[model samples]
Target: MKQVLVIVLALFIVGCSSTSKVALSEDRFLLTSNDPEYGYTENKPIELGGFLRGTKSAGAHIEYFEGLMGPNGEKVKVTRLGSCCEFEDKSMPFGGGLLDRYQLTYEGQKKPVIIYVNLYKFNKPLAPMGFALL
Candidate 1:
């Protein structure tokens, strides 16, 4: 009986443990959130279109932040963190692409804010909420 109980406990522990880790870039369980936050300020992102702007690589991302400012006209620094949230699109031959996530930091702010840019498609983007347009 003692040996049987030990085996049962070991099996239970092994069953609870996960063998694989969930990757940050996993596309199997991604949320499709294309809704633009035009009214509210939360999760506001500037639409940076590369194909429409005739740009490749990070050129379009650079142009979007060029001459852009913070809420109080503070010089905003744009940093390309990486890409996330892949989805299907007619623009790409593979029918899928990822949005580039940028880290925007400027003076007089608590910390930094992350902005998502969709460079695959072109849509004239308005100034992001709480940002000053040049």
Candidate 2:
């Protein structure tokens, strides 16, 4: 009985630790918008793609850069875009990453436009990553 109790306690501790790690990783990248028209928005869906760094077996890093073009042809470059880890869980086919949202405001516009950028890197074999405005 004592051995069983010890095993159960160890399992429980390991499970909680794993959960906390995931949560911490998730919180690293934050999603936020500042458009009064849209109010505060969080956790918006985003498509991921672009230059990938690292490998699946040893973990990977995903990188993407995009720009927002205004009606006048002015372009705003998005820097420090986003990132995701590709080797969190091997059992799961798909790996999870972080999402970032940006709000662009310009003169003469009544409201700012909200853009969603998703960063994802998975261990499973997948297609090259890229992103498009939605």
Candidate 3:
């Protein structure tokens, strides 16, 4: 009986402890919208979707950055993008996640360039936080 109980407890603990680590990859799961227009690609004028603002009780965590990349892989003019009153959450457990979408353009580039998107954090100039490619 003791062994059985110990085994059960161990199994329970293992099951409860199992958690999927949040990876900042190009995985589709990172996207909060299903507009099919959000993601990395050769497509210019990428769309940085919007999100719903979190409430006082339960909030969402959403962040984004955009910029143009240079030939030497240098980021320039990094911009912090957010929804209306969404970035105002300066408290713990940030407000709601992104829901709406915004667009960006890759102009003035004479050659093939790379654009990036950093999620949930401020990426450096031309540096994406989540996932991005040329």
Candidate 4:
């Protein structure tokens, strides 16, 4: 019985860690907005949603970024800086959720760009201004 319980727990952990869901397409990923403030600001961060699907929050972040490219359609590398800016949300634990921040760099970018993402609520992911959809 103990062995069975251990195996079950291990399976659960593996399942939660895998990012099995593919992100939405570029056209469907971002909102049609030209303002840089749209995704740069934590107040209006890009929404990745799908948090209730049982996958880990970090996995969702990676999944979404996989479908993105640089402003000039260049391949971009992303690093998760960390989580910040907690806000009230009925669907999230303790009635709030935190936004995830990422640093994006491309071949020609002079400086890395910081973008915000939300996972707690389901919102249409918007392609940030100055970013190219892949």
Q: Give stretches of model 3 more than 4 Å off.
A: 20-26, 29-134
Clashes of each: 0, 4, 15, 4
Candidate 2 off by > 4 Å? 1-46, 51-67, 77-94, 121-134
Best by TM-score: 4
* lDDT by residue for model 4 (3-100), tens: 99999999999987543333444564354457768779988888776656674453555566776766546667888899999888786667988998
Task: Please give me the total number of clashing residue pairs in predicted model 1.
Answer: 0
lDDT of 2: 0.37
TM-score of 4: 0.66
Order of candidate numbers by lDDT, starting with the best: 4, 1, 2, 3
lDDT of 1 at 116: 75
List, residue by residue over 1-134, the lDDT tens digit for candidate 2.
99999999999998875542111222222222222222123343333433244533222213322322333323334434343323343533465444555555543456655554443423222211111121
Q: Scored by Cα lDDT, where does model 3 land?
A: 0.34
Alpha-carbon TM-score of each model against the true structure = 0.58, 0.32, 0.24, 0.66
Best candidate, lDDT-wise?
4
* Model 1 lowest lDDT segment of ten: 20-29
Q: Please give me the total number of clashing residue pairs in predicted model 2.
A: 4
lDDT of each: 0.59, 0.37, 0.34, 0.72
Off by over 4 Å in 4: 1-32, 55-60, 91-93
Tens digits of per-residue lDDT, candidate 3, 7-101, equal 99999988765432222334422333343333333232233323223432122112333222322323333334433223323432465333222
